[model samples]
Target: MKTRAAEGGTGGVRRRPTLLSNAETWAQLAVAARIGPEAYAAVGTAAEPGTVLLTVNRPGPGPVVVEAPFGTRLGDVLHACGLRPGDSVLVGGYHGAWLGPVDAAGASLSRTGLAELGATLGAGAIVALPAVTCPLGEITRVAAWLAGESAGQCGPCRRGLPDAADALVALATGAGGPAGLEDVRRALGGAQGGGACSHPDGTARFVLSALDVFAPDVEAHIAGPGCGRPVLGVLPLPRGEGARLEVDWSRCAGHGLCGVLAPGLVRLGPHGYPASTTIPVAPWQEHGARRAVSQCPALALRMRRPERGPGRLR
Candidate 1:
């Protein structure tokens, strides 16, 4: 396994060279080395041989880590994680698709099997969204986050994604009316390809799948009254690493855009300044917070991800 580079630049071709792979790949190789390839091949399918580490999240306190054979049924995996069959599950992660009850139950943990149902076993993360929370709401929340994650180097990231995300927000809130679906479709189509990175394309895939899998909810929100379910922030975010919004009062010209963008999290005082310079942003509100910071005219608002304390290294 010739590696691209070593600690420095690609080490000039040597008689004997060090092999390089990701931590997971190296770890799996170690297992195969210890047990031998023949024994390792006996576990999973022929094509996708050996076991996979899955981070399974059901309607529980925390995620459960399990090593499952590649060809295992997703239903069985969910059951092992205390999820019932026919539950709505987010296969893969934010970039992945949503599988309704039927699809989720019939899906397999294999790459080929999951691909059949229009999903990939991305990072082996399977999340069973709770029934109490709104599926559309969760999708909207993630869409906003994805939109905010754009690097802004490409047209799709700079324009299309945020537009699509706004449409999604409008759709979820029942504000887009009958044109909601069309707006989302148009924006997604524009954002689908030709990006500097895969962010736009992946986000489109995620939003499209969510719309298909949760069509009933989409119809309800668009035409009917509502699902009456709250966005409980069920999906996990890396926000625990610490993040917040800071307003530079000196730079702020009291534009009041932050308040309008993130109304709940940021409030405008009588003088039109933010009630507080520092705003604690929740995982669900992070997208809105980001939008507020970006849309701020004076550029006073900025995101602050606090530095994590160093842990004791043994």
Candidate 2:
């Protein structure tokens, strides 16, 4: 992996101190600065006068990046890039949502246009998911990648993401029951808030939207042994941890509620002593682990993130 001196501190979200938009966004700004807005607007939409760098999923000729207008029809962009029939287009990058042919046909590339369909033109990257591939398996791989990329700052993010990814894997393999799906949802919810970044939020949005867009396929996988299709790894993932839950004995009454609720993560000392004060939560056990801490009647539980680097995850 490539590493660089972080512009911002080596912690939290938006780690770079610079105003970080997409590279293309910056490039467009530079162009507009050079030619002035009036000249730049000559070729683009009046509302958002600029071009976007559109990238494709695979290495085929159709998957190449193209400069497109702000008001260009999504269908036109795909057609220019050689989008095939039955291919689902994922607008935006990894965290972006996908659009089926029918949806893609009428979609526009503008931010306002995508918003109408509850999508965003984030990063201006579009990926075409081939119909032959198993969508869940593809999603599962990306989820794992996202889990691995955590900054290890927040409570749920450090622990919950792995479980979320695991649930997706189980679902794709048909080993996960509906309960596993529920587990996935819970993990996602746990990871959504209080994170240093929106990594969890964006990932959850992508996966949850998948559940909606591909409901029939999801149901089929649930009902059957497998989707029988391969996970082509159409989406890319950058390899990517967080915190522990500690209880203060002075405040903890050893209610044993935590142990009872999430026994896998917490246990009471002999005679409900709450002897073990620290519970190291794995990414997979984040939800129940947090629940155990929150439900403690004593309200002594707290998150303990490392001062630097990853701890157990490393």
Candidate 3:
């Protein structure tokens, strides 16, 4: 009988009815209220009014969040801020899609505008992936971050995210082969369904779009010894620990099973406890690691798989 709108609402916490708007939506609403309709309408399109904040990143003095009209073309916006004509853009933030120079040529900044380009104003951000950084690595980091952010409640999120992350790592590190791409795509498809929330689905969309936009980069990572650039960590994620292959410390009894099974990676200490470096399972060695994991007497080793998969959108 009561309501909660995420600010304590009509009811108290955990009341039956609730309405939740993301932080940006709430902020936009506040701005709209303060500015009044006429002034807001004067700045934007007829369909959507007022300004939207854009976090612009380029090879320059700033990545400041600028307020721009809703119907303004993104390319013009970039040009005004010093982006060259040929520079590529990735829209919708980490959870958004990549846009080529052409796709962004005359695209509007509104919801309807981006929808035409198969994108949404996700978190209202844009990043210019410079020519120097290895985009594959950046995407991988974002994917890994999303995987770690999971509540670990869904099967697909549990497996898919790590799998995707690993594939990205392998691809960037020159360890992933053809199987890495296959594994990534498969994980994305499998993880697309069945979740308590939209996190899995939204994350899938984000990664998949990168795959399409960065096909050349992906191929280069797959076909050879990497794309000749280091991962610049351009994409942002929550600071703490990134996603990792974890072990259940309590359950480990130092049986030496993991070391015997995956000798190259899992080393046993003097007390027979399994220890691993920050390295991941290589493509050729994954089968051995899986065998060791299945045979562990203590069942302590827990390697995170990459469900951080993406689909084509370039």
Candidate 4:
């Protein structure tokens, strides 16, 4: 491809084959030789040489096809390297995280990055999950943080995430039941796909992915039984402590009163106690959140918006 550079400078001529069309482009030319001819004509005014081109390879024992960017996600590459099936992996950059086994053998790691891990390598992403960690608990903790990171612009996300986080936490701690499960569904319905940004969507994706990947754990929780394991906190999240709400199921008594006080903020479970939403509380709604927090008759509800800024949420 022949292109121009800056004002008077002549752009360099480059040549390369389309990987999609010719899978062995790199293997034929070899990364060391750097001698491939331009495969297609360059676009634009030719005043710009375009930007840098990177070819990331997916880890495998077969032919290496180059993804647009050279450095694909480390986790995805590892998964392609034959990590055990159902191995939970982190996506996105450092901020994004998720836990799910590699279900689809050919599942590309691009889109999976953002919804789960707050990061993606424009192709693949980092993958790692150990046997000791509880994927459900790890997802719950990350969901809580994702909720707190919301910009709080929309009503649903602002009010839905914390509620979802609360339910997840309850499940994780063995204090939840069918009622908590209903709460999760409600929170997901209200917050997901409702915000201008993907914050709420991202949070929902994380939770839903957990539901799919940790069926055993969810089943154990729903059976009114414990997983008999402690939360391992395997997925990496922002450093430091975050504000959190506590629900004492023992004191809850299923009065169904909290829902009456804050309909948008809370829902009544099948068993009757108020269930919170998964939406993060926005700065503007702090007062309303506090009101809901103070009015709980069972004193089972509390709101913990983190003290730190955006960084804390991620």
Estimate, for each residue in 1-314, the C-alpha lDDT of model 4 and write its tens digit: 21244333443445322223233443434542453234221321132211213232222432243233232334445544555444555544223345455433333344442334443333233435555666677677777777667666787666787678878877776677777777887888888677787777666765775576677878787786656666766555656555444567677778766666655445576788655434345455556557667887768777765556554532
Q: Assess each prediction's global lDDT (C-alpha) against the native.
A: 0.78, 0.71, 0.71, 0.56
How high is the lDDT of residue 116 in model 3? Answer: 86
Worst 10 residues of 2 by lDDT: 1-10
Q: Output the TM-score of candidate 4.
A: 0.55
Q: After superposition, how far is residue 140 of candidate 4 from its true place, in Å?
A: 1.1
Across 1-314, the per-residue lDDT of candidate 3 in tens digits comes to 12465456566445555656667767877777898867768888999887788988754585777889889998888887777434357777766777776787678899998998888887777877776788888888788667657776777676676667766676667666788778778877778867777778777778887788788888898889777877766665543443234457788888877778766446455688754334345444566677777888877766555443432111
Greater-lDDT candidate between 3 and 4: 3
Cα RMSD of predicted structure 2: 10.9
lDDT sort, best first: 1, 3, 2, 4
lDDT for model 1, on a 0 to 1 scale? 0.78
Question: For model 4, what is the C-alpha lDDT against the true structure?
Answer: 0.56
Candidates in order, TM-scores: namely 0.74, 0.67, 0.70, 0.55
Worst 10-residue lDDT window for candidate 3 reads: 305-314
Clash number by candidate, in order: 0, 5, 19, 36
Candidate 1 Cα misplacement greater than 4 A, ranges: 1-20, 85-87, 240-314
10 residues in a row with least lDDT, candidate 1? 305-314
Q: Considering every candidate listed, which one attains the maximal lDDT?
A: 1
Ranking by TM-score: 1, 3, 2, 4
Off by over 4 Å in 3: 1-36, 58-62, 84-87, 242-314
The superposed Cα distance between candidate 2 and the true structure at residue 46, in angstroms, equals: 2.5
